[model samples]
Target chain A: MNRLTALVIAFALLLFAPARALDIQLTSGDWQPINIFVELFLGEENLNGQIPSDIIADDLTVSGNFRAYKENQNHANAMSAERLGDIRNRGGEYLITGTVNNKSGKQYTLSFTLYDTLTNDKIGSYSIVFNNENQRLVAHNVSNWIYETILSKAGIFHTKVAYVVRHEDGTNELKVADYDGHNRLVMLTSQDHIISPTWTANGNSLLYVSFEQNKPVIYQQSLLTGERSIVANFKGSNSAPAASPDNRTIAAALTEHGGLQQIYLLSGNRKARLRESKGIDTEPVFSPDSKHLAFISDESGSPQIYQFNLDDNKTRRLTFGSRYNVSPDYSAQGDVLTLVRRDENGDNISILDIRNGDTIPLTNTASTNSPSFAPNGDVISFIDDRNKKNLATVSVNGKVIVFWRDSEQGEIINPSWSPIKSDWF
Target chain B: MKKQNFASLATIFFALVLTGCAASKGAYSGNIEDDRSGEAGLAPVSAGTAGKASSPGFVKSSTIDDERTSTDSLLQKRIIYFDYDKSAVRDEALPILHTHAEFLNNKGGAIGIVLGGHADNRGSNEYNLALGQRRANAVRDIFLSYGASANDIEAISFGEEQPRAQGDNESAWQENRRVEIRYTDE
Candidate 1:
């Protein structure tokens, strides 16, 4: 009789398994970043021993939740038992070790493993192949996989940040780089300025505003093929381009020949303008759910952040404290919007909670704008002019902030992080 | 003695009022001119080559002629100042508007000007662009009222992107919040 009942329950579960799969939630929970330690790899010939380990350490540190420490010795492979004792003695909960082999030409292979020293077991092991040019990226992939295995969360190691850099010649160039600001590639350079770049959902294309045609025109550039086409070139001015989370719609701020700047939604050739007062409406960033748009409007008086609802065609004010709250960007969870708030001193970064309408100050440093969330929503990348206009990232919940700069490259501004797709990992 | 003193004081006050020598013209409103030394100057009540320090030769060529120096001096004033967060045309901007309007009307359709409006870096870039455009439109409206055809001028706003002065102080902000009357490069 016990066996018969167990068989019946198993059959019911098998029948309802599709429903369970359908109801699986894609959301992750609020958790704190953990500290992890990475041991140096054994092989130094492929690209030198420390390059891959340093890249992994940098990626982990930038993730906001992890503080990675390097052991100085490459002894995790041969003496696993002794190394485990050493890591435990050093107060490390987890240890990462890897080996590299140089193959023909630019081809190389990495065999990295993450160990749970507390449990005395291997948590993750990856065998990845990359050319010499992408060896560092392969190490980042190893870091991300370890993060996924440990935290049950998607890692941002493979993500890239797109931003605009102003050259000394007064020209602007769009470039993409590793999340840690390593291995940058310039996409387009123009005689005029480019501002407000947004990555599409698929991460294959980017929407940006360029003044190359002597006007603020929005263009969609394919990152793979380098083909460019104007998405929004109105009669007067077009700028502040952003893509919806669903990737089915595009939103941007546009002005006609003699009109006020207003937010408009586009789906192919069909377009509809959202209702806004005579206020100067611009910089419409779509919420992750695509239900509301957060934009900067000066309708009530000075420029303040306001949200527009697509369902009801109504706009509500989000910020009331600062008179100058602009350049807003919504977080990945759609619960917070980071924007620039101006006080008597200078512009500072501030975060606004959508639930209670309460705001918290992010940075006391002046001369910062365009605060964008990291793909994981655990970090934010903003343009920091505190030290000559470099790309800066800050942990969302922590005080750990890092700045990436190339002095030869002029002022860097307006950084946009790619979104994390369900299948990204 | 008290009555005599009262009568004498009234006489002195009335004489001073009638003679128009009580207060200087620029004591209160002239502080902004000092803040705008390197910028294009506004037309002044008195003509002593007031705005020549910054006005380009293109603006001074026709206005510096000897015959119409009075009106030409007004035309030399090319910068229009706006109140903070307010794009409406103010009374102080009227004289400069009249100067540019007269310049446009008298120059026929031969001269075209682009009214590029700008704002300080206190607001969002695109909203500032619209506010700057509102200012440009305000100038354009006043110019149209003064007999300049619509085609003679185009209104554009660079917003806060191209600031005339780069600083965090009030003086720099005052100089940056303006609408410049630029002659078309053509």
Candidate 2:
């Protein structure tokens, strides 16, 4: 959201003094993706390592903001001014060269230097020493650093995604993995159903609904220690748990109040009902600023998304044309909200800009549910069940779409992308 | 709850399978690595296995046992089907529900009953859960009005998680959108 920072100022000043005949800019809109080249990482004994470099290139390309290419050679002087001129001639705007040092048996050090090819200026350098088992993560961190330094926004390469996978025997497993659906760790396996898995504000725990007790109950479980405690276990359904930006409060849809679903703000040992509606109200999601809550209510005859402000205690309808709309989530910037709408065609994902009431459909497939936004607000993830059940992610601009499935036999649903990985990981 | 116990349980299950002590029919027989075969940018093109029966019946059967009495015949219709998205009990379903209510009311003591509400896999899961709860509440209110004790009935919604049919068609949806009257023997 902070578009006019010192980095943008430096970019603007450099833009006036034209370094090359090719036009290049670092902004979010219709600008083309900058071409970046990564030279193979130089190993400690000139072993010619390609693991980290390959991961870095793939990360940049998957981001959709950069077209990354890997050079065939690796050396200290690979980016000499002559070679840099050649790169500029071929529309390469950035270059990354790194070194991999294998310290001891399982420890490794990856050091990278970023350069702006057009201006021939050294942008920055990052060094990460990690266990060899975390090679992919360390490489992703390097890519994140390069991305933040260039685009002035955090990259989601290091984040994780939590989802539910139903096995062939009707057992549901709650799994968390890297953003690309690798390095999966099963959090819980139960014969009951699990729904609405969300990350805590600090990214240390997850809150979800499980039917293990023969009724839906919300539980907050730590990802590190695997310890969990029940958050809500009312008489009726306690589902759709949404944690606020502050680590204190949780918004959930509970039916304990007169047996009809209503939104409630739960904090510590106190619970306060927020809305009094005659119809069904569930799926309460908090804005990034924690000043407003968006939820699905059928008070208007059909399920539709509504936003309620915490300050004024006033509510406004968000979606008008749809007879069925639910599962509302806000982007990190709190500018846009993603939801699923059902019509004569089928259930599909759509995004609504709060500033202007413009709604754009993201997917046309039926059975799409639980659309969630990435921390960077550039991508949205949802479950698509048109032909096969799978987790899908689409760029906010709808230009790039990717699907992920755990296996060929089970059903994967309820995907929630986590915030950027904290430093503890 | 701790998740490490899941790993331990899985280890025990694998041990049981190795020793041929567990049911080999429905057990997961594939390698552990097979569950983690999701590629980075590709979706699997293989078809999923056929869905099995998932009706949440406690101990009741759809057919009568021994001599078919009138009460047994009435109780045989445990499932009360509903129209799509409508929770109101159909006219044809009222006679069986009345019989259940009278049977529970005339009993000497409290006999627990659970109404497991379900929906077709058509809408959002959360919304479907809400709809199922509504259907369960509707049936519970009718039972209460017909002289059934409120203390003896508990209603819970399973949403679309437990579907009796697997096909993505109107027939399957109609079969799935119903409430099952389960008698919990105390």
Candidate 3:
């Protein structure tokens, strides 16, 4: 092309580029959650068929990437092209059709087929043979498999979330539930208060701080046995225990020596100080790589989030925009840090991009704090007390907010989402 | 008619009760301006004036003098509120803390008191616990300077776990950030 024509084309492209960008921004985002319809199971002789369907529906809906609903039909054959056309006509993007059949001798077969309504493509089909007791677990595994197959992302349906709930009588209990806040089982209950429940790297154990003995002591509880062992019983306070990803050491705030709270790495009976100051330092969380620690400190006149390095022991402030920022935890990738920020209005949870130090507010509610990220880094669970103290999960992109409202007088305060069950599931 | 009759009946009953329970010649519920602080402590003793042993050289009744004792209600006003994220003693709470310090001093360290510190649910629980401890320590330091012994003081912090107020507003939060003085004997 000649120079004049090329220059004209370049100018036109520049002029149209911004307009296209604006149009893309204005339209319904392509990431808009897919509408999912889960069909009921057809073959079930020994167990209820709808249980598997509900599990899949809940798994997809809670992921924040899909909107799920139960379909009217109960046949696996309903996922054919003709049936899928009707689903697409009804604004369904994905169709999940399945069947649950009793094979014999307390064994059952559960299967599901995923279909793309728009393209009429059979994405994948999965099946599992599970014992009677593991019926619910089989459903969860199938949901995760369907999620990973369709969304190209790992699913957290099989994960567990442990949180401390304060009852009306001023007692506290450490409770664990499925990702959707279902199948809840109390792990520990104390007449005193308990705060900050975090999962160990194995995902089968928990590390939490409890005031069961009238003093704060960090304890480790096994999910399998319901037994707890004292992890840290320091003099002043032992609180905010964050288990390292390697499971070798725990970084917690201790006032054992000098009567001032500071971050320390506790392995067995030995502790190496991570950070020291006259000011208060607590809620120490490890980075995803376990190379650094971020905790709350008031050395700069107000409580703020600070990061201390492991290699050089250099301490640096990570939050500056807000006067009050605390209760910090990291994403699975360690690129984003979620913390509570306070302004004139009230306290709200926000995410800080560690790479650029850009903080983004995640919730507009008055008091939301103690955010812990899902293992996939897609959502962060925090506590807010607007109506009452309850556990809430917010999508990383700030699009979805799911409050675990099903709890009975649930005054859930401190929450930590368990890591991905990749080692088992 | 029943309400009016009940009101008059309640009035007559209250008048009789107040007259019997009044520690002074004035009204039963003394105003803050009553300045009869010592007289208020007598009502809590519940022992009638006739129970005291009359000894020689005690010409005047012990309760006859202008003795003032903090009333039960006044002594129970032990909560001291501080500003947000602050541990310093407020101006309004200084006199109350002073009264406590003097009571400790006059006892000559015979009695011990525990200062329970607390903070609002604004920050992390551990930080709030630390701040609450600092507030209690601030009170402990003030009490120590006023001749209160270190042995007579035990400071503990509950942080934001226990809140006196339940809302998310500043009014509730202000009440939650406080230090309460609890005598060990009680």
Candidate 4:
């Protein structure tokens, strides 16, 4: 009787399941994730002593679009009809097979072929080479290829994140780490306070404020050469550096004239003050096209997000109904903004659709700060300080939330996700 | 007056320890005598005297050590605490600011001072930075009103980075929301 009931349930599930993988709607939550079987790349373990298939699978799964599993039974690099049939029976809608070819010293090429298991058709084959010491970049690149081929959207697995770690000894270290919070490199260390670390559009350098001279001074440091240059060292506080998408301008807040903070755009040696207000204007973030800058200004008697149009210099408010809303970060598509909205319940991260004035709460935590959008515009990374300070990332739809504890001492603050860059180093 | 000076001096000493001021470290003792050299040009104002001297109660006497110690006592009250989200100077902290203003007005261009403002971990970092900048500017306004040179003063905000207390309670928040006045040479 139990076997009969199980068979009936299985039949019912088969009848209800979507007929084709392409028919599955990516927007709905009720649909099953597209199953992918990743086979270890040939010569991958021999070249770098690392498996790219595992990383690829993890990236696909973390993307919330696909469910990936490893296939160890098939050691063949090339897909066969019988093997494809076996994978199709195991619920794999897609299969990924790859090989590694060593080009030269420290240079290796990763070749990948994506397959549609249901149709038994080869989608395409792509290859990416990496000479950097980080072998993980190859896998991330492969995942990006698969993601873009399938979803028609860019992948953020290869991007980096910049954050500040405050040590117990009163020193702060500005660090850049991979998106997974590994392979960290300390960019700057100062005995005094350091805050507001931002990245250049090209991801070549960083702009941040350091109190090493007993006052906040904005400095731009190159990640490639480790050279540092002062961007803004005005009389009063100079902070909240946001690089323009064009890579030619940086918007920062300076308390120059009367100690009232105002936004300014600094490009090359010419500085242009954007706004003049009696109240505070800060936390400037440029849109993807650099056409407008969304910033925090308290000119409305309460802190709120405002957008400054570069073409006409007209200002419009983006957030309302809340007394306190600051720290605005624009999405890659420039359609939505991720920011912190504070109310009676405490601070929560919310995303605002720019087309309409609708707001969606991405974090329900009482105290979350510094919400920055991933390059893909599907996720946001922020600092959750409800208890101890930690890092968290949430999908834009508020469906997936992941928390990462600070494995080292001290609290992690000011998490800024880097834009999508081609090079890992 | 001597007794009052001793009591406030001890209190300031404890405050220095609590605020983690560098002067409270072991280098404090020997540096006290050296620090006096920089202020040697400063002449003590006689009681109820006129000319630039604003605070009558802060009249300096010929007893050099007592006079210097009293000045140190007043200077050691470096931190000015603020209420939550409020940058305006409180009534209780006005007297301390007045003392600092008189000193800055008296010192003239001999020294440079930096007012490091800070905030608690409650709000966004950059907004708190602007808030902190407001508090520091508030303190700087008092000094400027007393005829202190704008060139000799630099007001900056550290936001929520440097907190005097690490707890997530009201007491810690109050302690963390403050403006710290320090001489540039320190």
Candidate 5:
């Protein structure tokens, strides 16, 4: 029992110690569903409520990654070490348990803890004060926090939505709301019709079409300030106006004398026609590099999106699956193009791969139009008509997030995301 | 003495009846007699007179009504087509433009009108919107030069938002690429 025995014992302990430390690296395929259990501590009585648990679980599941479980809370008051060990042994990598204390008539303080089951260590915790009305949003915020801590990426929880709301007087009103469709405010209002509210290079300003004088005019207004001004005025119909990445020029469809719609560049006060064709040409979107413009035209006898190089002026058709495709909005990254593809069944928002020319349907709902990519390009927002009600920011994934919803305000159409907001404009 | 008086009365009655019949026939024909030449065989002073006569009296009565109806029905000569991305009033549209100019000059501040410039459904919404503005400005310029005040008129471009015809055909597009003069108060 001397120096030799002590050295052997030290080496044996070092070998087993490293194995006891658990550090699981999850992949896209290897990732498992996180099971969450919540117990509302309202004093001594443990209230059995599925509302908060279901809401939180639903929020996580919508990310298309998590599969939530519903378990009985037999030992709600006693969440002992032995019980937690049993939950981890059952292949649950993560566990969430929270307590909600009602402070006032409708207000409540929710304190939650997220645990990494493998290490039995508290990875993250959140305490939010909210009312009954904001329970859904609070749940989403907590879920987002957990997602970011676990995935090491920010979730799209705090993003807002932009959409068009039609009034009873047949006037279109541009509106902005939170991602969950709360705190809605009208951005643009006119007695005449308004359509296609596109976010400027800066997310603070919105570029949209207004028929105040009976002609469609593109106007830019600040979301923070109500100040508005005319950006471009072209001949014939000017419907779709997309701002370039630099935010200096706007790519628009201008109708010339030959009765053909052509793409034009309107920068400051100078105007130059970009693409000229005998057939109908419209819907111009600038690539991320600001060197190419993706637009729609009937040059091929049917409406299809075409990408035109700003330098070489060579044009190539981007969409081939549908005979009709319009309303092309380039993503912030300029990798994918979000547009509306119409067929016999009606219209649906689709994402087109610029490299492969393959189109993937983003929204299955018919009559989904004016699909726009968020500045981050992780989510696509569009207008959808459901049960005769126009809903803005109808996500392809059933996130039920909205910037505005006025069931009685009439139909909402044409939603465009603002460009990333800059300090200049 | 009695026979001479009766013969004079008969002569007077015949003259009055003949004059009345001639005047009625001229008015019923719906042709404005030329100030230079009072010839019935000559063409109507303006195509407007012929249009009025062709469509019976029971039809609409406004001067612009007959012209609009006639132009709308006869599509071939009515629509003045344009080149790609040009808002300049074409040679064919000169006559109509002149008519509008004259109306603007005569009416002046008495009427407030909006020129709704439209584009065919072919371009992006913003491009069409700006293009519509250019078209509207073109018409507004013509009206202003003809004596209409800029304040009395507003030019708006409805870039490809509203279409007169739905089809993506040449005919439909021709109808869409137009700057319509809409009067707020007539």
Candidate 6:
């Protein structure tokens, strides 16, 4: 019998049976926590459906809800309508079933359906036809749809991530791609080396370090035009270039005379020294108001993040939990600051609430570095090297979604999210 | 009483051995006894050679060759200092530059020389790399004007990666802000 007909017959049988005390007890209690099981079938056959099922489970768990279960055996033949009724009676609130078929060449067709276990009725259905390379993204969109249908909130499945990928020979390149590792593009390529790619106020341009001329110089590049130029040139070294919220000015760490590296402001051809410290001060980031700067310095004999007031030129230390805290990025709302904190154990990403200065750990998974915030400031993108390869983009709650996942390609590191989409040609 | 005397002798022997090892390695060499020969009129030697002389007890005679000895002697007679953030041979470095120029003019042909420029690690690595290249180029230009062939010289910048001192103080930075001239041939 067809799967739908079998499910209907099973539901009729369960309805005819008398309601037992156990059945009532199972149906009560907050709907049994809603476990959604997604299976992928390819052209009337099953082709390693467990992998995609596991990926969906991981994405759903990011919400801190949902207990997803995957049946070990292929259910394409064994799961009859009676089994569906039994699952419904056992408190499995929702069931998601899908099929993946390889069309011509790299093309693929994925069919999915979501069913309400309580009534054994089909709630929604979706069909995605795409290339094999886009399979992960299709899964991401499917997960997002499932999330929205259940929670009434929009999903971030379609968002892109930007990061720096460096080779063992010290060749650094900037890359941007979909969060699930599709449509990868190289933003900046240099033979010398590149570090710390930061997105402009609008996501159209990126500001980063390039050693094309044999020194650490900051450059701003247009993503569309592929044209780049030096933004600031200082005598000793220039690094950690961060654009302000208004895009009117840039804040960078510049070494002057014989003093320590300090924060400086750049506007056209004019340069203004913002802070004068006797210790090593570097890694400058600006607040949304552009009136204050956050940076890392070794003035205390160890690296720590500090905040400097623009109007009065006063400075204050922002991080107190660790002796080594560097690469601080302020949120768009100006309420949260994300930074990489390192101690004796290892490095991890932590978020600091500006209102109360309470620091919280975001990634306890592995050695996390280079944390950058999305335009909305709700999710954070960072590089995690625990899996042997430098994979980028770990969610604020430590759910790592790999960007550009083809194993044949090199690794990705140091992600900087653009403030907004760029209009520059 | 006999045991006490033996302990004192052993202590003395150990102290002698420690002193022997310290002198043999020649690690401490910053002591000078002044004997005025009324040679105050002599030009003050450059800091590079002065540093070498102050630590004479540490450096062995085998490492001091005739060419290096002569260069050290000449460097003492002339001082070269660059302008702030500039690699161009400043007027202050003219005396030393002229000395090297005359030497290259006299010797000539097939000599390979390297100009190593360094920064104080104040800026980003990229900017410092460029600044260091500029400094080396400046010295190369001066050497060329003084009769050194372009084929015989090469310039490279280290861009604040290596420093002479390890502290964040100004004195340490001043010492690190420099370029070294190295010649592979006499």
Candidate 1 on A1-425: residue-level lDDT in tens?
53344335434544553211011111133534454667667773435222787677667766666756665566546747667766655556778887777777768777877878777788778778877756756787787787788877888877888887777777667877666665555666665667778898788778987655334567786565444556875544677888988888898877654667788888898878877568778888888888999998777778888888889978889888667888888887899988888877778888889889988777777677778887778778887565655778777764567776634558886788877642322
lDDT of 6 at A51: 45
lDDT of 3 at A375: 92
Q: For residues B1-186, could you state the per-residue lDDT of candidate 5 as single tens digits?
A: 342353345434433443443344342222211111233431111111111111011112245533334544321232344555677887677666667656555654544555667788654444455556667777777666666666456565666767778666788888788877755442
Sort by TM-score, best first: 2, 4, 1, 3, 5, 6
Q: CA lDDT, every prediction?
A: 0.68, 0.74, 0.70, 0.74, 0.59, 0.59
> Docking quality tier of candidate 5?
incorrect
Q: In model 2, what lDDT does residue A122 have? A: 85
| Docking class of predicted structure 2 | incorrect
Pairs with steric clashes in candidate 3: B37-B68, B37-B69, B38-B68, B38-B69
Q: Fraction of the real A/B interface contacts present in each candidate?
A: 0.08, 0.13, 0.12, 0.32, 0.15, 0.01
TM-score of the second chain in candidate 6: 0.57
Candidate 4 per-residue C-alpha lDDT over A1-425 given as tens digits, one digit per residue, 9 for 90 to 100: 53344335435543653321111112334535677888868877522323677678767766667767666544346568888887787777889988877788878887888999889999999788876355677787888889999989998888888888887786677777777665556666666677889899889888988766456778786666454566876667889999998899999999877667899999998999997877999999999988999998998899999989989999999998999888899888999999999867888999999889898877776688889899889778888786445677776766556665444477788889998993435
Best candidate (score: TM-score): 2
Q: Which tens-of-lDDT digit does each residue in A1-425 have in candidate 6?
A: 33354345435644663321111111112322345554444343212222455556546643334545553334543445675676566556677776777778868787777777777777788888876545666777888888789877655555556666655554555666554444455655544456667877766677876545434557776555444556754433567788888888988776534234567789888888876666656778888888888887666766778888878978888888676677788876788899877756667788888778888777665477778776556567666665524444544544333333423345565666655445631
Task: Tell me how far the alpha carbon of residue A145 in candidate 6 is from the true structure, in angstroms, after superposition.
Answer: 3.9
Candidate number that wins on lDDT, 2 or 5: 2
All candidates: TM-score: 0.76, 0.81, 0.74, 0.79, 0.61, 0.56
The residue-by-residue lDDT of candidate 3 on A1-425, one tens digit each, is 33344235434543553211011111123356777878767774323222677667666766667767666476586446778887777677888888877888878888888889899998888788987756767788888887788777888877888887777786666777766665556666566778878998888788987655445668786665444466775444567788998898998877656345778899987898886687888888889888988888888888888888888989888888678888888888888899888877889888899888998887887677778899988888877766555567877777667665325675887778998983433
lDDT of 3 by residue, B107-185 (tens): 6654567677889986678788888878988888888777887756666677887788998789999999999886654
Per-residue lDDT, model 1, residue A277, is 62
Weakest lDDT window of 10 consecutive positions for candidate 4 chain A: A19-28
Instruction: Report the Cα RMSD per candidate.
Output: 19.6, 9.7, 17.6, 13.1, 21.8, 22.2
In DockQ, how does model 4 score against the reference complex?
A: 0.15
Instruction: Judging by DockQ against the true structure, name the best candidate.
Output: 4
Candidate 6 regions off by >4 Å?
A1-35, A41-139, A147-154, A256-258, A267-270, A286-292, A308-316, A331-334, A362-368, A374-388, A398-412, A418-425, B1-186
Q: Which candidate model has the greater lDDT, 1 or 6?
A: 1
Error of 6 at B162 (Å): 9.2
